[model samples]
Target: MLSKEELLQYSRHIILPEIDIEGQEAIKDSHVLIIGLGGLGSPAALYLVAAGVGELTVVDDDLVESSNLQRQIIHRIETIGSPKTESAKASLESLSPTIKVNLLTQKASPEVLNKLDSERFTLVLDCTDNFTSRFLINEWSVSNQIPLVSATAVAFSAQLAVFNQKLQHACYQCLYSNMNLPEGNCADQGILSPVVGTMGTLQATEALKIILGLNKADTSFLLTYDSLDTAFQRFNIMKDPSCSVCS
Candidate 1:
């Protein structure tokens, strides 16, 4: 039921056998919530918006800083003092005027997530940098049975994974224990600009695949990438029976 403009706009996607008109429709019907606007969230948001997702709700409390420009591709020099959420919304809408971009200019909280979940978010993308927010988002996704795509990039390395309540797989909390955690973020640890971009791009791909019903298998593996070595690694994610969130 695409308009002539939509059909022509998404012609490349509709032409592909993997994502024909039906898949494009599903893409347009999906509502994705992204919880960050930094390195990982930047490219993920751009690709998802360009891919014609029906609606996007982006959450970020930070303002644009000069240092962020190197990795945060969604913001510009003129927006350096702007809130990340407002800046990202303006940028995304500029890309696709028809796409809906909701802005939450504050850190996520249980109450806020509950309100959004009630409105029926199709899925969530955990693009946050800190473990606190990741864990919080993971718990919400798990409890609500919404699938989550989580990604991280720091110090030339990045990680990506999908966690779903419907699958018999490890939730983010199962793998990310307090004792075993990533040390620092790009601010102190240092990261190549494109390395974070790569991770964010991959995050969007997985999210789109899930929304299109193309990912039939449980994609719970911990996928890691090292920009320096140009290497990729995947490790199995075994569900911890004692996982408080998923158990």
Candidate 2:
């Protein structure tokens, strides 16, 4: 049952026909795991907390840096040199004190991933900046029959997708089988801050929709955003028969 304060806090969500009290309650019961606290993970974590996710487990090993302030909106300038998960916890707790936040100041090692699977997290948000982490998360999601919201942004472009083995959808490996793609990042190739912000925000929106069962079938499609052209492209993604994870 939603308390009076919770009802007021999520009143807007409760009013929606698709996400009335039932969906809002579902959001409160869902447990989401977010791996990464950098550019893409920052806003994703913030919105997920504000939207009333019941329990959130955030994992990141990096420390806050001055350069990250440009796009990592969850950390403060005064938090520089602190662990990102701790900084993010402060930001998220301040936004919604009722939600439970578990912080892990370590890499997404296999042991950690296995533990998360055992705990039966409702879903995973893959906000890491590297291909290795993305592939590993996708493989785990597929193996565990869990849903994964994955996104990537570079320069002025970003792409997002939801993968679920249960849905028979395309996994991240289907999109990028070769993890050896030329290495590039915001530090070296340069990224428009809002580019990652756009993808991160989309990741949060998709997570909420997944939890609420809103437009759930659209998980088969990939949404691409081109800030340079101010356009969004949507296309259906078929599960690759050769996909090592999904197939």
Report RMSD (Å) for each prediction in the order shown: 1.3, 1.5
TM-score per candidate: 0.96, 0.95
Which candidate number maximizes TM-score? 1
As a TM-score, model 1 comes out at 0.96
- Residue 149 displacement in candidate 2 (angstroms): 0.6
lDDT by residue for model 2 (1-247), tens: 7899999999999999999999999999999999999999999999998999999999999999999999999999989999999999999989998879999899997788887644558889999988888888888888887788989888888889887666767888887785457578788888999999989999999899888887557447789999988999988777778887788
Clashes of each: 0, 0
Weakest lDDT window of 10 consecutive positions for candidate 1: 111-120
